[model samples]
Target: MDGITGETDSLGVHLHYDLGNGDRLQLLRLATVAPDQPLAALVPLDGDGLDRLEAIDRLLRTLLGRKIPQDTRLTPQQRRRSRHMLQAIDGRMNGASYRDIATALFGADRVNDHPWKTSPLRDITMDLVKDAFAMIAGGYRTLLRRRHRGS
Candidate 1:
């Protein structure tokens, strides 16, 4: 009998089974199995008229062929943006006005010509401040937790 092996990784899961009489099967989880599918209903003792090994192999092939779920973690750029937003929040807490923070971060030109209430730069800066405060309140913990889980 040939040796059989199975492996799972970020891409998906794979299984290989060898029957002693030169037959072999390879199964890959590329998609989820449907509840009403024949393979989903397979059991060890209920092979119908097919060979037990063959039935098992078919069932495994169908069941295992599913794509691995994609990771939804933040990208490096997003993390950097979060850090910058936190810095803006810190600036606000330290007595800097919205215009001051905007000038400091985005340069004087972006803040000098526009009225405070209507300035796009001010709006963006305020949004960052809000996001930063949200992070401080609890959202930052999610990042820390993800880091620990990933490690």
Candidate 2:
């Protein structure tokens, strides 16, 4: 596999190919197959079968030097929120308090417009930090799937 990496796991040897742009494509090498050999996917019609199929399709396109498709599960708002969450976490890790993080994120002018105890930015900053910590504590896997409206 050109520039691909492999890691052994219970599922099998997982071959990971970095797609750049913070995205990665992984293929489970379940059976013996050479990199030069023609590859095929045998996805069963299970709960996550559709996701697996989409990944396989993306892998095929990647191998063919085609553009990989973006995941439609995340909306622009979600992407923005995720980025903000990382920023909040980074600020906190750098010894910044919630108010300081809010100041940096929302600007000092807006943060100064209201009292610290009642500013909405304070609450938003808190939530972002909490969400980021949750992601670090194994909740990041949920990013792979979209959340249902009622759930």
Candidate 3:
């Protein structure tokens, strides 16, 4: 027999199952559990045998398919920020000036300040643009490879 424990938090659900024979499984940020799904079917109530192993395999597949919730993965504000950064990077690639990108994103008054090079807002914007460009170049590919390796 296996004992199951679960809890929910801001990220999502965390689950741990201990199979009596020393095998254990831990799952984090499981998006959701369908109310009508036969969760109990994955646990053998009678005996621990080949049937339980098969059940575990099926459960793993089903849970992996669900994926982590979007909010748990990235907040709405973060998503918007990333989108803006990508737009700024695209504008730069198209030969738009930093001031022009700033004006388009934050308005003329915010970007028209003298000594723009020393401006905090301008510096932050430039940093974001640089990061976006790096991501487009090779950082994104590295991230994807890391994700696959981790999985």
Candidate 4:
């Protein structure tokens, strides 16, 4: 499994790899500009999976309101491992620097220095991953509840 890192405006979100199926573990944000935002959420599909990656690409482009550079395809591996989004947000919010917060949350040795490009597209992609999982999880949980009640 790949040790993955992604960030949204310096909020310090990360995605680790899962050994079993190579799925991205989830994005975890240690802090945020607003108190209401969640700390973490899972992406439903593997970060390297074709459908999910394409979806993410489209999502980022739309959110940024600009076309991805013609040569840029935005492969999942790229998004799965990026930490720029989190750092950028931190920069905007005047919060603790990314290095400090990331070190605190993920340990000093583990934090990498790769930069992530932040835009509306990146934000949307992060959100979509969470939403996709919630919708599915909610359906299954509801079904389980109904089944237990019926029994």
lDDT (0 to 1) per candidate: 0.67, 0.83, 0.65, 0.44
Best by lDDT: 2
Model 2 Cα shift for residue 10 (angstroms): 17
Off by over 4 Å in 4: 1-72, 81-83, 104-106, 109-151
Worst 10 residues of 3 by lDDT: 142-151
Q: Which candidate is the best by TM-score?
A: 2
Show model 2 residue runs off by greater than 4 Å: 1-37, 42-45, 146-151
- For model 2, residues 71-94, the per-residue Cα lDDT tens digits are 776789988999999999999999
Each candidate's clash count = 8, 0, 0, 20
TM-scores of all predicted structures:
0.45, 0.73, 0.45, 0.20
lDDT of 3: 0.65
Ranking by lDDT: 2, 1, 3, 4
TM-score of 1: 0.45
Residue-level lDDT of model 3, residues 128-151, one tens digit each, is 799898888777643321112131
Greater-lDDT candidate between 2 and 4: 2
Error of 4 at 105 (Å): 6.8
| Cα error, candidate 1, residue 86 (Å) | 1.6
